[model samples]
Target: MEPENTTQNKPRGRVVMLVDNGVKGDSRVQKAARSAADAGWDVVLFGVSPDGEKHSWKVGSAEVRLIPKPGPLNPRRHDMRRPLFRRPLAYRSPQVARYRVQAVKAWRSDLSFRQAAVKAARAGHPGRSAGGSKARLLVPRVSSKVYSKWVALRARETTDLQQRRSMLDARLDRATTALWQGLMKQRSWRRLTPNLWDFELAFAKHIDKLKPDLIHAHDFKMLGVGARAAVRARAAGRPVKLVWDAHEYVPGLPPRHGRWLPGHVAWEKEHAVFADAVITVSPALAELLKKGHGLSQLPTVVLNAPVLSPGPDEVAGAGPVPDLRELCGVGPNTPLLAYVGGINPVRGVETIVEGLTQLPDVHVAMVSVPPGKPYAATATIRKLVDKLGVGDRVHFLPFVPHWQVAEFVAPADAAVSPLHHLANHELALSNKFFEYSQARLPQIVSDIRTMSEMVRSTGQGEVFRAQDTDDYVRAVKAVLADPERYRAAYDKPGLLEKWTWEAQAEILDGIYSRLLPDRPRIAAQPSGSRADARA
Candidate 1:
């Protein structure tokens, strides 16, 4: 193939991706943004502001604006429903519980409204009882004494019904506000600030200012927001395709810590009906869409891949960041096991911690590169490290910037992910697994589907019984002794191929392509097994 005289940074379509701003330092988002920018999409991001700054939006090569989630009116919102007010009762906080009570009260209003309508019909009025002539005509003629008695009885009942209905109406109004709030939750109040409304104008307004051909919306968070923008553009008679990348079983899940709403499920189906194209990430998720819902018909499943060339220097420059022994205060020959990402129970961080106690010279440096909330639990993990007498070994790097991650984990003897025995964990495809390959660092992973199959297939790492701390410890010792012996397994020719964001964005590129078939088609279907794509 002849090399074309082209600049790598040629612009594509104007794209506006939505993510939490604090995740600016997260490698995944960074890679996604880089891929979109390199492909020539005028990309701008809208995330919660980092500082106390409010309502910020930027435009440029790849603009990143930090908008306050809890806006000027309500800067520190405790309810998640109101993007500006992100408090959720799911924390079971007194305030959240009060909101729950209010929710029940609001639903009761709907019931009351129905009752009011029935009573009104029975009284010979659809909305209210107007005794002008219709009321008198509806009632039968009788003696003055009998008629007076009937009128008195009816008036009392009418007054009681009206009072009850009025109360319910007020309650319903309040409940609607609370329920809507519970639907939009982020880890913190600030994170929810920029997402002020369910349909954010700032997002569409920013995108419109950029004016891209196709709008690719990831997750249901931006489904309606992006679709509405497409509708507005369409009304203006602009031919814009609204692409939805469905990452979850949206209708299958409910609002965070919210009671199931039959209406929410209906709403997702409605949104898909309106979208130009819907893209899904997983086959299972796609299958669920098809089987559980009639969404299999939509052209979906753009495999996560990279379209751009790998930065040779990133891998070439990939070397250990710190002296593992010195950083963790262990002896020169102590075993240093690394685990990246935030520490969470589901990811099996606790199991890793518990297993580490049994190993001699095993210092688990959990490079908490990325942090997410439910702070109380994260705090608890740090305490466990201290209480377990491994305080010196386990350290939480609450915030790890993207570039420096290479430096932190480069020197690790081996990396491990001891996830619990959950179906989700079995199919896990975390960045750590890929990063280990990139750095040539061997791994000791959980014996679940994706990680287990990966370890067994590639021999790049080892796997152990997921919850069995004893097995995890045994595997760690085996890998630390001779990681290179098993290196032949995972370091395949195309192993590093898909982990890059440039590759991953191709999946997005595929979804967007169907949206605008008339546009140029530069994407190609990659040759791989289903396991490879899933991994």
Candidate 2:
């Protein structure tokens, strides 16, 4: 679809979408922003920039304003000597001390066990005492020398290892310090949060300036941000409406290394009550939010589907499209399996690479963007491909724009969504499910509840046991064996239409209309139309 025309008459009211992450590849936020804009609301998307650069740009009728997070908040820019000060005082509270102590004790116990085992092995056989007296005495002296020498060598090795570790630690500290000093010199601290209080304080000030009619928070973290902003706006007599758009089952999200799930769930629950309305991405997630938060009503389910065009030929764009066959240097008849979105661990991307080993003839095209930080799976996947000897069959494509994703998938024989059966993935109905349907390409989805149900009900594709390499291989092979049968499923009347953003957009519009009944609705203008009526 085309970007919304900004030259139309002035929007009736303004909406501010608060998100924690950058807006580059966020399809859900983009869709919501465009839907609101199409329905006559001026949209301002407030998000964090990746490079910590504050900037603003217009995307159709929406204006994206990004805030650069402060260096103190980023671990890469941490001053090792002063890192403790960067954490919020509340995070260093006594309650957190218990977890830290437990972790430290566990690590110490493991290290002690390893050292004890090494010492015991060096000491040697206990049964040697049963030998003859002379043999024992003579052996003990010789053994003592050997043991002493071995122990000395081990001590020297230990000292060397400790010295190396200390040197590495010092180097890391210096690097962190340099980065922190550089960021501080740039004066970007003004945009950053020294602590949670500072972040909320800055966010409130930014929200106050926008004076939005409604604050649409994208996820649980932003719910707090939006609620705080709403309070500030109301105190200033703006009285903005708050809408919590929960993209995942926050409480059920799989635990990560440093994440505090309980605290996040409690925070979301506390602030969710303040929202005028709550909406989620799936029916299952909506139910979970209602019960989890003890809400009086269930959240509206707005599936993450692509915008459907009138026909397959009208998907989007008329420009020169990149050919997957030419890009991969493969023949046209070669079976291509396309996987799109972020190549993250939880997405079961490893299974895809492993499954490709079983199917030598099938070429896998991963159309994805690189994930941030140490969590980047593209490097890992590439290493796996080389190790498994599937480098010739696997191809990695640079990030395709959301609008042009179809172009990449169109040439492929089938699309795959092999999400692991985590609580969040189990309930999620991802955009790829519908994107493949819109392109009339068959899908091979993991046997998660929501996505599996969609695939089964629509008869669009096949489902495989999630995280099972054999099952994924079998599923893809089955589709590739009979591609025509699965492709015809999309040809069914009203199937693709029901899964489009246009359908979800109506539900989103209805929620907004009820929330702001007094707000006038302007007729949508044609693309590139002049604002003659307003002029």
* Highest TM-score against the true fold, candidate: 2
| Candidate 2 local lDDT, residue 365 | 86
What is candidate 2's local distance difference test score? 0.71
For each candidate in the order shown, give its overall lDDT on alpha carbons.
Answer: 0.56, 0.71
Which regions of candidate 2 are displaced past 4 Å? 1-11, 51-53, 71-198, 235-237, 256-259, 308-319, 369-375, 526-535
* Candidate 2 residue-wise lDDT, 424-448, digit = tens: 8888888887777776889999999
- Candidate 1 has its poorest 10 consecutive residues by lDDT at 526-535
lDDT of 1 by residue, 298-341 (tens): 44654433223333333344443455546667665767788877
TM-score of 1: 0.62
**Candidate 1 Cα misplacement greater than 4 A, ranges:** 1-11, 20-26, 48-60, 67-197, 201-211, 247-255, 260-267, 277-283, 290-293, 296-325, 330-332, 369-375, 403-407, 421-427, 510-514, 517-535
Candidate 2, run of 10 with poorest lDDT: 526-535
